[model samples]
Target: MTQIAALRVKKPDAPSSAGLLASLRGVSKAYATPAGSFMALQNIDLDIASGRFIAIVGKSGSGKTTLANLLTGIDSATSGSIRIGGVALEQKSEEELTAWRGRNVGVVFQFFQLLPTLTVVENVMLPMDFCRIGQTRDRRPRAMSLLAQLGIAEQADKLPSDLSGGQQQRAAIARALANDPQILVADEPTGNLDSHTTLEVMELFRSLTREGRTVVMVTHERDLGAFFTETVELADGQIVAIHNGEARP
Candidate 1:
């Protein structure tokens, strides 16, 4: 195992698919369009368990991003309920949700949204700053450790622009993990990378699940379904099929 991999907290084997981490029931979202209200998502009922890698897949405009946003409390549901780690999201105020989200959920976007001016390590430390997660003196070491785990610690002092696409994504993953969230939500995280980089990034995400983190990702790559513990397929904002990942009997 790589040194960083060896440093991870090894949890016991993942148990039978129990223990709900996040759930949604009758969830829907609508946006005001010039043509009037446009429904972005409708009646999504999903149950996500801890210590599993889940992939939410659909064609373009199939509400993949919308589902992720709802999971992370970024978009308000027009109807229904969302509970993550058992906390009801629909009832929390925007301000309260922001704080809760910062501490409980780590989000990764496709764009690798690192501040251009901040050094790679600083980007990772930013989450700790906002959440007040650790001692100010210890934040840098923690961020460096996360970067090392992702194999990008050598680039810590460099700006995002100086890193390769794969390295930048690695750095972003490190940042998402800054607060040690139990759940990690990623939307099209590999959309901008090349095929090899895509696989590498996916492998890193998969490893996180082994260490007891629930990973929810929105992806269009159908071929990668086999790597996930569950695959939820969406069409026109509704779930069409849910393939529970497990060895065939």
Candidate 2:
């Protein structure tokens, strides 16, 4: 616990909490298995603001991933209301949710989910094609810009197989940012990389918040929490603690 104790950060210039960009109220998720129904999350209520860096951490089966999935609308909660940027998610149909999620949220998977056949820039541009975000002529420039921002512009023409793991992940992030969504959600983003690569990817995440992008990342690595404005911890499908750098009156 010394490492956790040593990471007593201070976010003196924190953003206002008056306007929540994402909210989960009375949320719960249960799955049916051979044994019985298992509760993955239980009545979780969380609020996150724009430009905040949040680390959701816990042991295995603690609902950290479930919480992320709920936020991204990748998985539906058994019960509760989920609203992101003032839009409700519960009543949306599958098609509606897909369109809405593509418009509002950007998700980065643990493994770099780039299509092996496409070039890095093409991978980034794929989102725009799927969502029809902009003109065809504009997509390539936008993709190029994202790749440049992620420090992978030089490898924009290379296939994912040719890039290093970190580079591939960076490309994936660029692809996620293609739609310019307000919220960015990542699940164990650095789980497949070395420490140095992990730091690089984490640094990129930090840079996103500075650019007014709210970032919610699930991580088991305690050390990475130091960079976040706050850490939300879970245990037994419940929020156990929140370690925050800002003080409350």
Candidate 3:
């Protein structure tokens, strides 16, 4: 218990009785597959507080990414409710969801989804353009600042292919933060990085929490559980446990 205590971050206090930053109540997701309807998630209930770093851990086909997608509005739930920052996802149209996602959610992909043709800074600015955030002239400076904060300012002008995997991932993270969203969802964010880079990215996420940003990450690496304030473990599309830090049951 002492070891686990040391590993976990000192998260911000829970919200004052009002509600959570995000809530999933009786959520289930199923996809139409050749083998009938495939259930990716079943009866998921989760509450994410603002300024908390949460790790969703599970093996392949454990519904980790599916949960992330649902939170980010990339995919809708088959049956149930998902509300983030007081906005109910089920009530929004696809077009409305897209616009809301641009301003409210930041998504980091596993494979560093930076555009190959655009420079790192340009890639970061793409989100701002799509969301129409701030003046066009201010977007470049904001992108550069984000890259600088990620310690990759020097790589800002380079193409994604020119950067290393870690650098590219940093740029992708910069792009994710382009709109300064309150919630950041990462799906297998460090799946392609080396151990050192993985730790670096994890620490970066911790720092974000310090700034009052909520981070939900889907990762299979239970060994990195120390960096999270909470852990949600899933198996065969069902949440088996949700506990604080390394206290698995």
Better candidate by lDDT, 1 or 3 = 3
**Model 1 lDDT tens row, 137-212:** 9999999999999998999999999999999999999998898876788998999999999999999998887776
Error of 1 at 25 (Å): 1.5
Ranking by lDDT: 3, 1, 2
- Candidate 2: tens digits of C-alpha lDDT, residues 21-125: 666778999999999999999998776664467888889999989998888888898999988767889988878889988877789999989999999999999
Q: Estimate each model's TM-score.
A: 0.90, 0.90, 0.91
Tens digit of lDDT per residue, candidate 3, span 1-249? 000001121222323334356677889999999989999999887766544688888889999899889989999999999987789999999999999999888899999988889999999999999999999999999999889989999998888999988899889888988887867889989999999999999999888777666678888875787888788888999888777756242
Off by over 4 Å in 2: 1-17, 246-249
Which regions of candidate 1 deviate over 4 angstroms?
1-18, 246-249
lDDT of 2: 0.81
Q: Candidate 3, residue 83: CA error in Å?
A: 1.0
Worst 10 residues of 1 by lDDT: 1-10
Q: Local distance difference test, per candidate? A: 0.81, 0.81, 0.82
The TM-score of candidate 2 is 0.90
Which residue pairs in candidate 3 have backbone atoms (N, alpha carbon, C) closer than 3 angstroms, thus clashing? none
